[model samples]
Target: MKFLLIGQGLAGTLMGFRLERAGHQVEYVDAPEQTAASAVAAGIINPITGRRFVKSWRIDELIPAARLLYTELEDFLGVSLWHPQPLIRTLYNRGDLNDWQARSADPGYSEYMEDEPATGRLPELTQPVFAYAGVRHAARVDVATMVAAFREKLIAEGRLTSGVFAYDQVPALLGADAGARNGNPAYDHIICCEGWRARFNPWFADLPHGGNKGEVLIVKTQAPLLNLMFKHRVFLVPLSDDTYWVGATSENQFSHEEPTAKNRTFLADRLAEVLTGTTYEIIDHRAAVRPTVKDRRMFLGTHPDWPQLHLFNGLGTKGASLAPCGSQWLADYLLAGKPLPEEVDIRRFNQPLR
Candidate 1:
């Protein structure tokens, strides 16, 4: 079967990899500068979140498969992208500490959450941190390297187009009986994975795509606080020896995805207020809009009127964690004619968000 994937972000990359591995021919069209959310994202995949230290949405089912996925890709690309580092989650005050204790009492919570403290030569945090640090099993992938590797892999095999592609350039699917890529017609079974750019895709653009403009900073923090990616609304991911990624503000109604000095200052101020760390220098700054929905569930499944057409975006903040499982399910449904899991089914929008 011939599949046409729009953007080469995480979702598109994983889904396309699955399809291509299944012997389906895939030719992706990507506008790199315009569609590089994977490059800017601090792709941490911790299973615990929030002040209460609750488990992430689907950590149990997805966690096991995630390591294998990234490891396989890393070996294939010859670059280590995925990281299994601990996260030091600090408790700001008394109330937050109590909530963490109460939640930890539950068996469901204890497996993934803990009340450990910061150890080793780590700098003293202003607030006492009851850290739930662990190997987390999940790792942060170097999104840009993996994207470039896959893009090159696909292109070298004559499966990629490196140019801006307008929607009309996509030919329709050959017919219902056609295979995914090489076996059948492509124009018919197009799945739009354009990220925020999906708004411009004539076919799936009408779907509700609330935009979140996120700004991230690439900084050189000579302080080698390695072994984990730190997160507390803002993330300080260790990039190379002397680098860390401090990011991300969820701003709405932005005119463009370009980085703004105002947001850069805002991100710096936010990180500074949290931790008293070593002096840092901003190396690069970028911003991109995530194609999100009001409910935060991704838009995945065939279009209402066109079963052959599909959509995959809106992992929101958890694209790193969710895209692996979500894209696998999408590939399964697409190849085996199985139903999409209820969580991400596009038709479920008609049902009120619980």
Candidate 2:
């Protein structure tokens, strides 16, 4: 089958790769600047979260898939993108420590959680009363580099087009059963992976998209680059060249995608709380809206009315971990006669377009 994948962000890029690998032809159309949440994201895949010591949803399935996919990408692209770093989760108080201890005792948490407490402290951070715990098998992906490399390869193969996709022209361009031609080629399916912009897509606009805007800051510190990710109220991820990625506020109510002074101040204040006695220079600030959903589940599957149209989006904050597995599942469903997991199928809405 031939496919036209819209929006070459993380979701679309991964999906296109999967479909192509599964013996299908794919062409991508995307405007990178407008849909850049994946590029700006910190891309950390830590399995444990929250002060209450809860494990992330479906982390067991998500992590292994990520490890396999990123490792494969590294070899395929001849570039390094995966960093298997541990996470240092500092305890806020006695309750937080107790919660960690209890969660650690559970056998299921063995793979992601450490049973022992962290021994040392960073000279830059104030010592917590109960110290910190480590979450192993945590990792970060270089999203920007990965996406750029893949897109460049696609462009070289003449399989990608860089431009704004005019939604109104979609049906006219791709309405026939024999498929519609764009210049020289015809496509059998059109998959929408428009990220937060899906809210404006007429076919998918009513799918309960509760998008959230997130702002992130890139800062450089003189301190030696740490090998692990650190977290308290906010995350501090170490990057190349003694730089760190700090972020991100989940603001459901926002005016635009531009970074605001208010969010800058908030991130600065939070950074000061966790990283003390460390002098850092602000390198860059970026903001993008994520395709979050009201139910916090991804949107996958064909449109109820248009069988040739499909959607693969709403991985949201967990896109780094979710995209690998989600894309494969979508490809399987499209290429084979597999059914989409009920939790992520768009058909769950039970409403068709008018």
Q: lDDT of all the models against the reference?
A: 0.74, 0.83
Q: Which stretches of candidate 1 lie over 4 Å from their true place?
A: 125-138, 169-188, 274-277, 350-354
Find the 10 residues in a row with the least total lDDT in model 1. 171-180
Task: TM-score each candidate.
Answer: 0.89, 0.93
Candidate 2 residues 1-354, lDDT tens each? 889998998898788877877788899999865748988898999898876677888889998999898888898899899998878877767788788888887878867788564534453454343567888878999888889999999999999888988877666556543343435325678999989888888988778887899998899988665667888677888888689999888899988889999999999888877677568888898899888988888999887666778999998888999999899888888888688888888888874422
Instruction: Tally clashes: model 1.
Output: 12
Q: State which candidate has the highest TM-score.
A: 2
Q: Mind giving the per-residue lDDT tens digits that candidate 1 earns over 168-255?
A: 5444343443223444455546777877777777766566777788989887765665556766668877777878888888887888
Report the CA-based lDDT of candidate 2 relative to the real structure.
0.83
What are the clash counts of all predictions, listed in order? 12, 0
Cα RMSD (Å) per model?
A: 3.6, 2.9
Candidate 1 lDDT at 20 equals 72
